[model samples]
Target: MKSPETFEHLVRAEFTPKSTFLNTATNALLPARTVTALQDAVRLRAEGRPLDPLYDDVEASRAAYARLAGVPVERVALGATVTLYTALIAASLRPGAEVLTVENDFASVVNPFHVRGDLKVRAVPLERLAESVGPDTDLVAVSAVQSADGRIADLPALREAAREHGARTYVDLSQAIGWLPVDADGFDYSVAIVYKWLLGPHGGAFLAVPEDFGDLVPVQAAWAAAEKPWDSAYGPVAELAHSARRFDTSPALFTYAGLRASLELVEEIGVDAVHAHDVALADRFRAGLAPLGHEPVPSPGSAIVSVPGLGRLQPELSRAGFALSDRAGHLRASFHLYNTPADVDRLLEALPG
Candidate 1:
């Protein structure tokens, strides 16, 4: 797992001559295999054939997601991004119910429901979130990993606490899914943007709606969600899909091809390996930064490491061919499977003391 030399060949990292990219929090580098898939998708689209769910790669993409999430195939649905899926989940909650989230969660996770007007939002600090949930809580919506500080949420504990309050859990896996081992079992609904950690095509995402959520209303409607999406009848009422797919958002027909390739590449590498590689990178980073006396965030073990004063160095470092995201008053250095210890070492050497 510590093969820093061979690991460097896995990504398009050298596309930039003198640059080191530590910014998966903003955008990820596409794997070589994924680029090939994109080319194939564009070529196939040029043949002037209409897209069909059966003929296209949608089903295959769905299957890949199901396998990764350990959920039944029918329980998965594709969305253009996590925003649309979160909106659907927010729309389905009982009217006027409370959605307990955190103030530091990324906007996409909180804004979708907060804008609803009908639901009351009680956003608190992450440390107190589990203690704050009570019987009045109807939904506990949060990111599996806090976007601001890179703190991994205690999923099993939170879900168990939410259960006591009869609250359904909706986890935004955008920051966790591909790089970490996430269990979709405890959460009633989980959503993720594949491009971030999955190294997939942009605008590709998935949502999981387990039957444990009971009856839910699809927030939006598309003919593609009908039981017979291909039926030319186009009747007044659509016989919606029995699975969570009834809530499916319209997909980018060509994008799924690349997405499937990306998913396969990640699976081939195995998430356990990805997580191991990611944590190792973080460990090295902490050790390197520790003696320098930079401030580390709450969880140094996570893939995303936040440090105070790192944000101020972004401009100077960018000129030196390194990249990271400045978010929530700190610079977030995120790692991916494609990243190697050499990448971390480069940043360690490059950063200003």
Candidate 2:
């Protein structure tokens, strides 16, 4: 049987730029199966037949994603999370409604709040999010994990606070979903990218909106998102899918195929097992940091470890043939299924003691 690193090597070797290092930010790359699936999906599209089955695949992909995310299939919306969030924020808000957010939220999330008209913005401390969800705040939007610090927010508290104020909560689970366990049941709505942790292709994301908000329209719509099936007789109308399909931006065949493969891989290795492995890798990294006298920031101590190392680690790590990320006052290390104990050890050896 192939060892874990051997399996990773086989997958990585298939890609170019022979250095073959894994990116710590996204944790893993497209495996051979995903690449093949993408090629097949593209070839099928070239034939020019109606891809109603592709639509079914899209629905199935979200169902698989919802199961992995611990949410009901009815709650899942499939699309680019950023695009979906823009539509959701637009639909959910009245003119001049307040959106309470934190300082360190991801750019994709914060941008929608900033650009939207008829919306007032309120910034709050990352820790005091619950307290900031005041009566006037119509929506409490946050990244489940702060992109800057990699801090995991206390989601339940945020959900409770939003409910107390008659406000809705939108969670950006891009950085947290696969690495850690997220209870989508807690938030009124949530958005996440599939590429980062689900090991899926780019251009695919998942959104879980509450059942009651079924009437809420997505500002961005495609023919696939129409109320009726795609038939020649009916003209294009943005009636939207009654289910989470309302967020679809047409059928993305290649990406959906890649996403389906990744989802299958995730299922093969249970999410619970994946989370355990990731958390253990993170714990190992944190423990090693102490020996080098490098301290990790308090909040994102596990799964993703961020630290104020001696200098910008991106170039240094890159020069050393290691894949890692640096941003917002700290160097971030994300652990995924592909990472091994040896990789962690090598990372430690590369850092300044």
Every model: Cα RMSD to truth: 2.5, 3.5
Worst 10 residues of 2 by lDDT: 13-22
Candidate whose lDDT is highest: 1
- What is candidate 2's lDDT per residue for 144-242, written digit by digit as tens? 887655678888888888888888888888888766777888777888888887788888888888787633666666665666647412565636667
Residue-level error in angstroms, candidate 1, position 166? 1.1
What TM-score do all the candidates reach, one by one? 0.92, 0.88
**What's model 1's lDDT at 35?**
74
| Model 2 misplacement above 4 A | 1-24, 46-53, 232-239, 309-311
Residue-pair clashes per candidate: 0, 1
Per-residue lDDT tens digits for candidate 1, residues 1-353, read 53545444544442332467788777777766667777776766687655553236788888888887878888888879788877877778777898999877899998989888899889988877888899899988889887777898888889889888888888989888888888886778888887788777788888888874454677575676777777713654358777777777677866787788778877766788778888889889888987777867877568999887678777887888887877766878988776668988988887767
Q: Which candidate should be chosen as best, given TM-score against the real structure?
A: 1
Estimate the overall C-alpha local distance difference test score of candidate 1.
Answer: 0.79
The CA lDDT at 87 in model 2 is 59
